[model samples]
Each structure stands twice: as C-alpha cells, then as structure tokens.
Target chain A: MKQWFLGIGLITVFFSQTVQAEIVFVTLEKDNALAIVDPIAGKLLKTIDIGQRPRGIILSPDYKYLYIATSDDDTVKIFDAETFVEVGQLPSGEDPETFALNPKGDRLYISNEDDNLVTVIDIPNKTEIAQIKVGVEPEGIAVSTDNKWVISASETTNMIHWIDVATNKIVDNTLVDPRPRAANFTADNEQLWVTSEIAGTLMILDVKTRQITKKIRLDIPGVSADKIQPVGVVIDKQRRWGYVAIGPANRVAVINAQTLELEKFLLVGQRVWNLAFSADQKRLYTTNGRSNDISIIDLENHKVTKSIGVGRFPWGIVSKP
Target chain B: MISRFFMNRFLLKIILVLLLGHTALTYAESIQVIKIAYITQEKKIPAALSNLDAFVQQKGLIGAEIAIVDNNTTGQFTQQSYELKKIIVPVSADVVEIFKQQVGEDISLIVSNLPRTQLMSLVNLDLAKEMLFFDATTTDDELRNKQCQDNILHMLPSRAMRADALAQYMMKKSWNKWFLVMGMMPADQAYAKAIKRAAKRFGIKIVAEKQWTHTYDARRTAQSDVPVFTQGVDYDVLVVADEQGLFGEYFEYRSWIPRPVVGTQGLVPTSWHRTHEQWGAVQIQNRFKAKVGRWMGEQDYGAYLAVRAIGEAAVRTKSRQMKMIKDYLLGSDFALQGYKGNPLSFRAWNGQLRQPVLLAAARSLVAVAPVEGFLHPKTELDTLGFDQSESACNNLNKETLPVKPLLKGTYDSENANSYQQIIQQIINKIKQNF
Candidate 1:
C-alpha cells in the first residue's frame, strides 16, 4: 500500500513541468512493469504493470505500438502506445531475450535464446511468419534498414548468421570474437557493427562482404579486463559517433565512427546494459541493471548529465518524440 | 543381482525440420550430419533422498536426446545435422567387445556414463585410439589425475572440483571452520579426501572429523540422533561426505547448532541443478522438461554438456573429423556456454571443463561458486578446480601460459567501480526468502 501511494505521488510531481517533454519508455525487469518518464521533466510520469520479466523493449517505426519481450511469460507483449492498452502478443519462441523490428515495422524478428531459432511475426495479421534456425544461444538480433538482410549473433558459436529477409533463410556465416553479444547495421545499411562481451571489443564489418573491417579494442585506464564486458551497440542517425555499453565497467565507450577508434569512456551507473539515442539524436539514455536507474547522457558534449531512478533492474530503454 | 538383458542397441534417427520442412528444401544446401555414440554399462540406480523410487523417471539417455534437438535447431542454419546412437551394455554382454564391433568407423564421437573401472579400461583400449570419448557420469579424481588420457575429455566435475567449489562458497560465506562427517562407502572416502584437499587449498580449517558408522534406519529418529552425531567441537558449518545418499540429507535442519549442512548433500555444489534458474539457465531447464517430461538430473546435465560441446566444436570448425574437434575444444579459443554466467572452457592441465559449480539446496539455488573474491591470475574459473600448477597427471604437460590482458589497463585493486557483489547477495537473499 505504501508503494501504491508512492507511485501516485511521483505521477503528480511529474505533471507540473510537462512542457516540451519527450516521453521515455523503460522496462523494469524485476518490478515486472513499464516505467514511463518525461526526460525533460526529469521525473517518472507513471508505470504500468507490463508483464513477467520484461527485458527487450522497442517502439515501432511509426511509434504506434510497443513490443516487450516478457521472457517468463514466453510472449512478446504488445501495447498500444497512446492508450497503454494490452493489444496482443507475438509468438515469441521460448525465452525471448532480444528482438528487432524491421524499418517497415510490419515484420518483427525475435531471437529464441533457448530454441536457437529466430521467430518472425507479421505485425498486421498478428500471425507467425516463420521460425528460422540460427546458432546456439542466439541473441542480439537485428534487421538491416533496407530490410534485405537480418543477422543473428550466436554467443556460443561466435558467428553472425546472415539471413536473406525475403526467404527467411540463413545465407552465410561470419566468424567473430568469442561470445558475440549484439549486432546492428549502419543507418545506411552499409556497415555492420557488433559487440563481443568476452573479448571486450567492438567489430565493424563491411556489408558487401560481411567481413570485419575494424576491431576497436576498448581500454579503460584503470578497469580490469574481465570487468570490461561490452554488450549493446548504438550509433547516432548521422553516423558521427558510436557508443557501446561496456557492461560492469559501468561506462559507455565513445568511438569515432569514421576512423573507428576508441575515443573515450563516459562513466555512468553500475552494470550499464543497453543504450538508446534520444528521438532527436541529441542525447543518449543507458539502463544500469544493478543500479536500478537510467543515466542520461548529453551526446553533444559526451557527458552523463543526470540519472533518474526507475523500477528495479531497469533494462531495455527507448524514446518517443 | 545381475539380471539377463535382451535389448542391444537404441538408435535415434532425428531429422528435425520446421514449418512444413520447407526451410531445408528452399535452402538446397548440403547438410552435414555428424554421428555420436552414447555407450554406457548398465548399473543399478542408487537410493535417492526421497522414498518415491517408482515415481522418478529414468533420465540417463534423455539428456543426449535434448542435446540432439538443440544441435539440430542450430544445424539448420549452418547446414549441419547431428544423429545419436545409444548402446547400454547389460551384465550379460562384454562391454569392450560390443563397443569395438558396433561403434564402427562411421561414428568417431562417443559419450559414456560408466563406472570408474569400466571407464578407465574403456578409454585405455586400443579401439579408443581414433575416437574421442566424453565421460559424463564418473566423478573419480583418478581419471583427471593419474588415469588421464588425451583422447577422452571429462565433462562432469571431478570430485576435487566439487569440493573446491563448496570450499570457495564456504569461505565466501565466512563459514571457515568446518565439522567433517565421513561415510562408509569407498566413494565417500574418496570424497572426504578431496574435501580435505580443498580445505587446505582454500585456507579453511577443519575443526572436527567424525565417521558415520551407524547402520540402522535413522530417518524417523533424525531429529533425536542427528544432534548427537553432529555434536563435537563448535564449528561454523557441518560438511558431510556421504556420496551415496546415506544420511547427509538429515543434517540440514536438524544440525546440533542449527548451522547449515554442506558438501555432497544438503547445500551441495553441483554442475547443474533443477533449482538453478539464473544466467538463462531456466531456458535449458524448461526446454529439457518440455522434451523429456521429467526433471533434468545432474548426470543428465553432464551428458547434455558433452553433446552440446561437441556440437559447438563441430559447427565452429565446420568439420566432422575427431582431430579437428578435439584440438579446437582443448585449445584456449573454445568457449562453450553451459547456461552459467561465464563461458565454460577446458583446463589445459587436465581435460576437466572449467565451470562455476552451482551451490543449491533441495528447492533453491544458494550461490554460484568460484565465488566473488577467489582470484586466479588466468581465469576465475581455474580457481574452482585443480589449476595447472596443481595438476598430477604425467601424460598432460602443465601449460602455465598467462592470458594477455585484453587491454593494457588495470584499475587499482582496492577501488574498482564495478557491480557491488554484496548488493547482489542482498538482492538474491531477498528474492530467495520472499
């Protein structure tokens, strides 16, 4: 009952400075809810009970719907963005940890971390499209901006499986660093960026050949090698810089996208997991699972400006204009 | 009590495909099918803690079946397939002769769940020259020490590894002083020796040692008798060495000082447990149950690791030859995930796989060990088992190569800004108790 009153009190405090506010969506892994915050207001607006063990969260291209991988529930729970109503579920194969939405937002690609398969679900019809087999313990799924290629990075196999989007068939495999965690293509769909957790490095690949072009080794001045686990990878829309969430090192590595060199590490909260660019591409938000907060970074200056405490184990994060 | 057996071989021809089997047809790619043989000598099931022997489902070979399904799902993308052939030798048959005749040139990979004597002789046979063996059942330290062979890899944690894992956790919990209870069986004696080795290695002191010689049924009078059995020199925890489920289960709650019981039973250290659900372990647990319709046992998990490790090696090297796969697995590059937080790898000094042992009770996971502060220069996993410097095998050369730090950066040991492990423990305790 005390927590219930605290939730309502936070909502009213968030209502005072709602001017020019952009809403941010954060999935609370331990609280089993979705926390909505007004980044401009620097306060949590409200939180809705989402689902069980919600982790991977994303908004559709048009920002009409929200998809969350409610892992324990074994379904990707979809919510209507505006109304916050439970819409339906995508047939996420068991233990869906991470997923990707195509640029068209009509197709959703989800990695079944248990089944070692990628499940594709059509958005409009709300039906299963296909289940494409990948590698063992597959995670960090992404579809190219062109929607022509979808890559699944298998942590154990350490290979990125390239699937032709049209046929939903794996066409090729590229060997990578040990325990590859996440992969993404450039905004132009020309270069592929990948993060290796154990190797503590970010790999960039040429899309034409699917071969590694540069392997940027991350080095924090005083941090131990084992503590520098790199996980999520994100680059701004302009392709000016790239940031990799260095897990446990509690920092986001800034890399000059052009030269592909490690610039510096921006310190954040403890166990910083995933990263998301603001809708305007001017700021970045990081989810620190251990700290139960999201650190806001002013991308213009590469500085951690503020941190807002959210629900327990605050995991996946995204933003709306 | 050897009974005449009739069944000779069980073959599983799994050609799994999804969605009308059209994925395979559309790809029109060459699928490489790798054959693996599971050879085991038939043995009697040991007594369990519970009295429902009839209710427990047989789970020896089911773990390999689950692995085949998992391997095939990944193989669908890599154009590689896996097929398993099982042969459980009965008392009436000659195990070596059957293995030499049946598992021919076609199948070079084999996983065995056999006794120490049988496994020792089996891996030493001339027929084992070309093939690689995966020992999934036996935990005898001799196989990892004196009887170690190049062709065979021990997938299960050796008795020493389990003891070390427990000692690490006990040290982490500040349960440094221990009262030891030894059981009657030979295996129990071997376990007791391993526990002593662990205590000395981890700086833990044993305060008292006693022999469990009572043979009467004490289940009903556990509360009355356990206190007397556990009484002697004040200790932080009672560590039992009952390997055959004799009387260790009764010590958890009924100890003389209301202390926690640990070791082979009670809060035991294991490679896998049903109650372990962290680090995506729930995925494999649920998948195993969904397929086998039963709980995955410890031995079952060992077999699962064997099959999946081979699959990982094969797919990574893209080869079916035993030489390539063996070299890749023993090499420093091999990292197989056993659903533990860290990637599982093989120890260079011995073939035992280095993994974090799960410390669990009957219904909950207590902690994962190679605990937080037990530091090793190479990898934290090496701290769990016999390191390269402590290896006793003559056949294996002790390679003490230091891993090149990924970056030339090092934080001050005392002031690292990392995930606070103490906070994690508090969080885990809250979740566990609630």
Candidate 2:
C-alpha cells in the first residue's frame, strides 16, 4: 500500500488574481430544466426547458457543445454552447443517471442503472460503441486522463469496476464503501477518490496498486455522523485542496491534499448535493436540493458569499467559459 | 521585544501540549467495556403457521448477533469493547428472574423481545431504572403512550404508525371508503382498532366493520367461506387484520367484489420486507441472508437496530457511561441510519422510533407512506407516528424532551411563512386524526 505523507510544513498558498466571466449550468432533476447562472454577479440568469429528469451535465473539451443525461427519457441531449439551443440527442441506455467524458472528448461513458451496464457512445456518430456489463445499479462513471481506463461505482454491489478502455472489459473490481455515488481522479492521475453516500466516508484508491490508501471519515463534532454523507468531490490542481459536498449536513469539507486531513467545514444551504468550480477556480458553486438554491463559495476567502435561488430540486452543476 | 515574543509563544505552545495530554489521559481512563444483554423468549412457532412462515426458526436472536458484530466494528475505533449476553427463556420459564440473573449489575444496555405483560414486568423492576431497554419486537402502541417508561426506547414502528402510514397512502390515492374485517384473535382486534383510529384521523370513512367468527380451517375452507363472508360490503378497499395468518392471504382474489385488500393482506405496512430493495437495503439484506441463511424479518431488523444504536451512541459521545448515552439517545442529536432513505430518530414524547413505513406487496414494494403532502415542522417522518404536540405521555422527564434547537438565526418572512404553513398542516392533521 502507498502511504500518503503529509507535507504540513511546506504549505503553498495561492490567491485568486482576477474574476473570470463564466456561466454556471445546474440541472434541476424534478423540474426538467437547467438554470443558467452568472457566477461573477452571483445571480440566476434563466431556466431553459430540457428533457425529463435531467441529472449529469458536462461540456465538450473544445467548449462547442454541452451534453446532458436525461434519466427518465433515456437519452443524452446535446445543446449548442453558444446558441443555448437543442442541437441533437443520443440514445442512452436504460436510466442513464450519470456519465463522464473521455479526455479527448470523442466518447461518452454512461451508467445504465437499471441494466447494470456502462454504455460507451461515440460523440460524432452518436452511436453506442459497446455495452459492458458490470455490478448491479451502477451510478458513477469516471474516465482516466490517459483514457486507458474507466471506473464505474455500483451502489448495490459496493464495489468499483475498473474497465479497460481498450478492451471494454472489467479488468478488476475493488470493494470500497457502501453506496458509492461518485468517483473522480486526482490532478496527477495517480489516485482515485470515491464517495460513499451511505457510509459517509471517502475512500482514496492508489491507481497503480488498486488498493485503498486512505479512508477519510467526515464527522462534524456537533452534527450527527449519519447525516454527513459525502457526495460530490472537486480537487483544485493549483493548491492541492479538495472540496467535498456533505449531503444533509449542508456543509462542504475542505481537505488538504498532501495530508488528507479535513481542514475545515463551511456551512451552506440545506441538503447540498453536487458541486462545480468556476473557470478561474476562484469560486465554487454548490446545488442545495432541499433549499432550491445554489450557494457560491469564494475559494480564496473560504466563505460562502451568496446563495441564489433556482428551480426545484437542483441536482448537478457545471461551469463553462 | 523579539526575544520576549518568541519566549511567550514557546510558553503558550507548552501550555497547549499540557492541556492536550491531560485530555487524552482522561479519555483513556474513562474508556470501559460497554456491556449489553439480549433478553427474549425462545422461538415459538405456531403449529398452524409453521409451514407458511419462512423465517419462523431464525428470528430475533440472529438479528441481535448481527447488530453486535456491527457495533464491535465501531467499538474497536473508540477503544470500547462491546460485550453482549444472550438470555433466552423457554415458554415455561419465569422470564423476569432469568432476565435479572443474566443482566447482573454490569450490563447497562439491553435489547428485549418479550410480549406485552412480560415487558411490563421487566420495566416495573427497580433494576431497570439505570438501564436502557430497547423494545425490539412488540408494536403495541400502549407501550408508547399509556404505559410508557422512560427507560425503554422503541426500535419498531408502533401500531398507529403503521396504520397511519397506510392511511396516508390511501388518502393520497383518494380512496375514501374502507371495509374493515378482522379475525377473532386479540392481536387482530388491536390492529383493527388502530386502523379505525387512522380512518378517523385521515378524514376517511369506515363504510362497514365486521368480525370474522368462522372457526373453520383456513386451508380447508378459504375458497368456500371467504367469498360468502365478504359478500355485501360496498367499499372502495377491504382492510383485513388477521395477525395469525389465518385467512387474510386468501381474501385477495377470493373477495366477492374484486377490490384491493390493504391493512394486513395484499398491501401490507411493515418495517422490513423481503421485497424492499431501495436506499442501500439490498446490502443489508444480502449480508443478513449470508449470515443467517434466510431473509431478514421485521423483528430481526429491530434487533439489528437496537445493537447498532448502542454502538452509534458510544462512538458519537465517546463515552460508555449509561447516563450520558441515555440522555443523548433521547436528545435531538441522535439520528441513526437503518437503510431507510433518511435518518431514523426516537421521539422524545414517547420514545417511539420515527421511521418511514413501507407499503409492500408479497413480491415487491408498492410505496412508502407519509406521502408527499403530509408535512411536519421537524421532519416528514413525524407525520407517520404520534407527534409530541398531542401525545398522551405527558409525565416524561423534561430533560429527556429537550426542545429542538433551531438551525438558523432569526427567521425572515420566507422562513416564517414556511413555518406557519407547517403548523397549519399539522393542525389540519390533528383535527383529522381526532
């Protein structure tokens, strides 16, 4: 096992230089809409009509088109980034709850929860390249930077299947925690962080060894441990700081990447679900499902500066320049 | 001035180190074995229903064992070893004396799976004053209201909670009329009374009520006598309460009119069912099946929850003292995860557990109750059971029923409006229930 040594003495601090103009897109699962927000002004611009049960949102690498997985309709709807108009749609598998884009941005890997398969689609042709079988109720999908592997987290099986992209086959399955919701790769692509919503813990796996290096337990002193469920994770590459959205605790935990220590927890709205970072990485936006709003966190100041109301049940978020 | 600043900072660091050391030493000294006991009657399978009940042999004891294993997992981290002693008394044995002998002085927490009278006897003892008894089996509402004890905390949903859960869903569907039919047993009659209370509470009408007086064998005469007995009822749904599994299952398709059966029959309200597979329940179900060689039943889940509650309390409070744990268990901060979609907590008013009751069919879950519009000030789960505002148990200790602390500071108009709306909803619910 690879042990992470805490670089406590040599902490490097970075300051936000200038505010970047960015538009934040949030998927409202129940409303079947996406609200566009101006992060710099901390205001919601408008909600655009979308398909049924829209959950995961992402942009192509070139920022030309946006892709959204509409779970109820079982389709990935594509919209023009500049025009904000519906461009086309791709046939996603049954109940496509979440998905991830490859590094080169030509393929999309989506989790079909009902079918227990990951449907890989070719972006240009909008055709499924393969459907690889996995554990039951797969919800989270993450692609490696080098595009050599894709990891899918199964909620029922309580395991993460590492799929070889070249062969479209599960190479190894590693069990982590109960009810894993999402997975993300570190900046250097050497570590994988998977969040377990039910266990309320984050397991960091060493990519090379395929072994969990650390299990970070998020327990706020005064809050109930059962309510502090870790969901979405975003790590800053410049400062090696990780931010985790704790579900019902309504707070974000900041972890020092070097030490893997929970440094601080900043309170936000009720039942915070997912998170996104602005273009310049100076601001972080969190979707609060119960409060029907989004909280803006000033990363440099480590404070929630504002909360802007949006549609009902705001689910996931993404930011594009 | 620079030398003095450095020397003062060094002294402050030394002082902080000394305080930390002192705190660690105190924690180490305070750590002790958290002893728990499971007191219950041996497995009693009725001869009539032995072949029909799949989980007759493996019930409460296996669930308690699973919970002990789960508690020890967390206990290892807190430097507390959890020790459990199982005391199973036979049908002819004296339960009170055996429970007392097994629970000797050291055990401060207990999980009990006794019937109503035996449980009352256990709680009336002087030895129970310092112990926390988790009632894991009985669903009798009287234990929660009329004869409630401060030392006993309920782990299972009460009779009213289950009835209210079914009524809420029925109301959501706008099924306004019900026909009630119950067996001759006392348990069936008690459940029928609970359903009638739910009908009054939810603004629904009980179109007709009757008792099943047939002593004919269910297997021999279910098809012959059920249709004739259920003939002449003009109702939207039929609610049957046959607790001993006599003829409730036969009324689904054998009813004179082809209506749905709800209460204890076709669509049943329960805590844990074999068909429930949501909210990470499949993991626990699989785990229990692997360990016990059968599906987990309602009593088993209750026992599992009892042991887990003790472990969770110990780990969170970082102490094994019974007083601290007892206080925290009833406080606003105690929330346990029982594979439901949300956190399950005990009500301060009656010690009844607040949980989402599942309306399940035999093969799949139909829906969960305390449906969309049934609201509460604190949580939606409060709508299912007896709320604190109008409960019968008023003599509970004030310290145990601490007023829930508000999360945010001063409320704005939006917050105030939502609070008012919640109050109005609760008032309407109370009026309907009464």
- Measured with C-alpha atoms, the lDDT of residue B211 in candidate 1 is 88
TM-score of 1: 0.84
Docking class of 1: acceptable
* Second chain TM-score for model 2: 0.85
Candidate 1 residues lying further than 4 Å off, grouped into runs, are A1-19, A71-78, A87-97, A155-157, A198-200, A216-228, B1-31, B52-60, B219-221, B397-434
- Model 1 pairs whose backbones collide: A222-B410, A222-B411
Give per-residue lDDT, candidate 2, residue B211.
Answer: 90
TM-scores, one per candidate: 0.84, 0.59
**What would the DockQ be for model 2?**
0.04
Q: What is the C-alpha interface RMSD of model 1? A: 2.8
DockQ of each: 0.26, 0.04
- Which pairs clash inside model 2? B201-B432, B201-B433
**Candidate 2 lDDT, tens digit per residue, A1-321?**
123233332221111111234788999988999999877667788899999999999988898888998888889999997778999998798778789999999999999876668999998998999998776567888998888889999764556899998999988877666668888888688888888886688888999987789999898987755476888888887547889999889999998888898899999999898988887788899999899999999999899999999899999899997
